[model samples]
Target chain A: MAGHFKQKSKAKQDIPTASLPDIIFMLLIFFMVTTVLRETTVQVRTILPKAEALTKIDQKRLVTYLWIGPKKLPDNAIGETGVQIDDALVEDLSSVRSIMYRKLVEQPKLIVSLRVDGTSEMGILMDVQQELREAGTLRVNFSTKRDVVL
Target chain B: MPVIKKKERVEPFIPTASMADIAFLLLIFFLVTTTIDVDTGIGMVLPPKLEEDVIPPPIKERNVLKILVNEQGQVLLEDLPSAVGLVRDQVKKHVLNNGVDPRYAEATDKALVSIKTARETPYDAYIQVLDEVWMAYFEMWDSEARQLGYANYRDYVAVVGQDNPIREKIKAAISIAEPDAA
Candidate 1:
């Protein structure tokens, strides 16, 4: 302290506080570089049927969506159980294999979640599931409408 | 000659933080480089395990009967059904005809419960159909007055004594799938 004061004769030098800022900057850079940014796209187009009893699924990072469209079911009524997807028509579930294979390659343990119209054909639904299983997507879930009182 | 007589002034002390900054930066860099694991989204309400959860009963894969529901909500057993009303009968017939000896998988105590149902089947209709199958199993057990032995199955039917009703037998159980879509 005496040495420092002895040289305080009308002269001053500034102490830098850049260390904390540098550390914070480095942390931001690290997260930006390593965090996994999942690319999510629905391989099949589907319109979710309206259910007063529908339940909202709560899953964020590890979810893969499979939509079951009403297309190809020749006997289906227009409004009976229509599902909506991005301005695209998904006529078949056979394409699920390729898409799932591509995604599963990235993460083998990924879980696939399906959202199908209530009135969709059981056959198609099962077919989709079978295809996923064949593609090694063993973890599966069905979204449902939890009856809510009017 | 006059300038040489003057003395020089020394600079005062000042603190520098260049090292601290570098250390902070390194710490942040490490914190960001770690990869995080994500959760799997599948959800299932599995049946609770018995006390002997890991008993590892049999190496045999039980025989399964498939019940399919087509787009029109028609129930198909082995690809055909005469009447929705007859579903239970058809299942019962299949279960009974499973050839009772070591030849028949189901009747020989190795039969699997009914097979899987498509996910898009009307939940109500599916539940109704499953209930009917269970009812059929009970009815078949009663009609034959059959009691299972501990050697083949753990279930021992209790004989009716005035107050106690005769316990019915259940065909061997099996698996149903959790469908991916509607």
Candidate 2:
């Protein structure tokens, strides 16, 4: 009996790691499904205005972002304020209509999200609005941070 | 001669011992790269562009509450200077006048909160103003729903969702005018 007990104590106790790969695969699948790779790299800096009574857009696929603010590089010869569509800078405001019209045609239920800087000139913002109106994408969302205290 | 013996080859197996490490690496990469920003904003439907400027129909003077945000970031209520903090209360009072005074909105249904922003006005100020107006309407609905036996605003909304007649009627009263080119 003493010899049997000594032999049992000498035997190595190994943790079961055979299912580790399977567990890892499950986690990988979960992350792949949930992770949304950022579609476009932001070329401009922006500080969204703060507000209350904000409504969130439920469907990510149905929204298009329009970033209007000073150029990310202030030292550039062109003025600081500029309109950026996706990753490219929009030089002419008039062209905004055609570009947005094409997007609207592509997705009829498209909701344009305006991510304008807090201190940006409203003239450019309004101009963008007029172009959106002409494009017939009348649904606009002025993206803002929630003012919790107020 | 003795029968020649054939050599049997052992099948090679791929090592998957580090599979968890690979998956963890990828998961950490995605975790670092992902930005879970939930988009929220004030939604507005703009009128279609016309070939010529069309003037809005005249609203009763009492029913209209004109809020102006100027280039200097100053807020004006009815062309008189006003602070941003008091806007919600002022709007609520006018909206809930309940036909008690001729100088205010004749009824909740008739109230119109018109917001006009200057071209140079800071975007922050403009959003703040709109937020206050929307808050006023929401507060009114909360109290009104409470009177109807609903516990609170959220409860009332849960009972009668956004598409109900009451919400539609109230939404019609809030209008945003074209921004002034100041």
Candidate 3:
């Protein structure tokens, strides 16, 4: 009877799952390596408008962002829209040219991506464009959402 | 009596049962932290800033397609109140109207689309109009490319744009003036 039981156990082979942990570990390492943390926290409120003609930027490393919209909290109480480059709010408009020029020097193929609020006035938007042009950063993209067609 | 020495051997195994659990925890952490936001938008090349004002060559009124957006978000196509949806069609019509009529574009090469907006015009309206104008040119190029036996305008541009002078000239002909404040 004992020999019969051993024969039945041999016939019922277990599937080997020894390598599954190693595979999962490799996947975990890949995800950890490729993950990029969020860089800058947006200070101003921005609602990008939707548009039909949108071209995606291929190289993210070559692009820089500039945001324009109303300030947050008590600052908004002052009733002045603010322009932000990365983290800080720009007080003077002319300084935009110099700041962008410095960035252009670092990355020659720099593209200025303007994230302007939909409700914002065109005057400030155009001013930023003019500054970018002055800085020789002619490649500009107006960041917008993809228009949803039902 | 003889003195005997024995070899002490022990079996060892690294415990890996918890490895999968650790990996799963890490995977969950990455999944929670990952943000896959893709940046895309309408791109334009701004003309270089000029220190001195220079008079542009006089373009015939017939050859220029003027689009203006006022502060009230009303669109004016050649001083006529028009709907935003009509902008692309009107622009396409004006560009391809290469007829002998003096009031229309003499040819595609001579046509120019000029966009001007009021200072207080909403950015949304301005960008929408600009996007429509760009679409007009894009569609024209795409159709022209298809007629030339290419798959699409992007294919034509990629394969022929660099070495082909005609293709380059055709691309250069479709021009939009720098956006101005009304």
Candidate No. with top DockQ: 2
Off by over 4 Å in 2: A1-15, A74-79, B1-14, B51-55, B180-182
Model 2 clash pairs are: none
What's the lDDT for candidate 2? Answer: 0.82
Give the alpha carbon lDDT tens digit for every residue of B80-166 in model 1.
664456767766665665565332245524455444565446534543454456556556655545443222111323334323232
TM-score of each: 0.36, 0.85, 0.84
lDDT of 1 at B3: 61
* Candidate 3 stretches greater than 4 Å from native: A1-13, A74-79, B1-14, B53-55, B154-181
lDDT (Cα, tens digit) per residue for candidate 3, span B1-182? 13332323434568878888988898889877875577889887787776678865678888878888899999999889999999989887877788765666778777778778777999999888988887877787788888889888888878876456444434433233455524
For model 2, the docking class works out as medium
Name the candidate that leads on lDDT.
Answer: 2
| TM match of model 3 to true structure | 0.84
Candidate 3 chain A: worst 10 consecutive residues by lDDT?
Answer: A71-80
Candidate 1 off by > 4 Å: A1-59, A71-92, A148-150, B1-111, B116-182
lDDT of 1 by residue, A76-105 (tens): 434333322233444455667777778778
Of candidate 3 chain B, the 10-residue stretch with the lowest lDDT total is B1-10
Highest TM-score scorer:
2
lDDT of 2 at A80: 82
lDDT of 3 by residue, A1-150 (tens): 999998888874876778888888787787787677878887777899998888888788888999998777664543468899988899999999999999999999999999998889988887888888889998888999999878
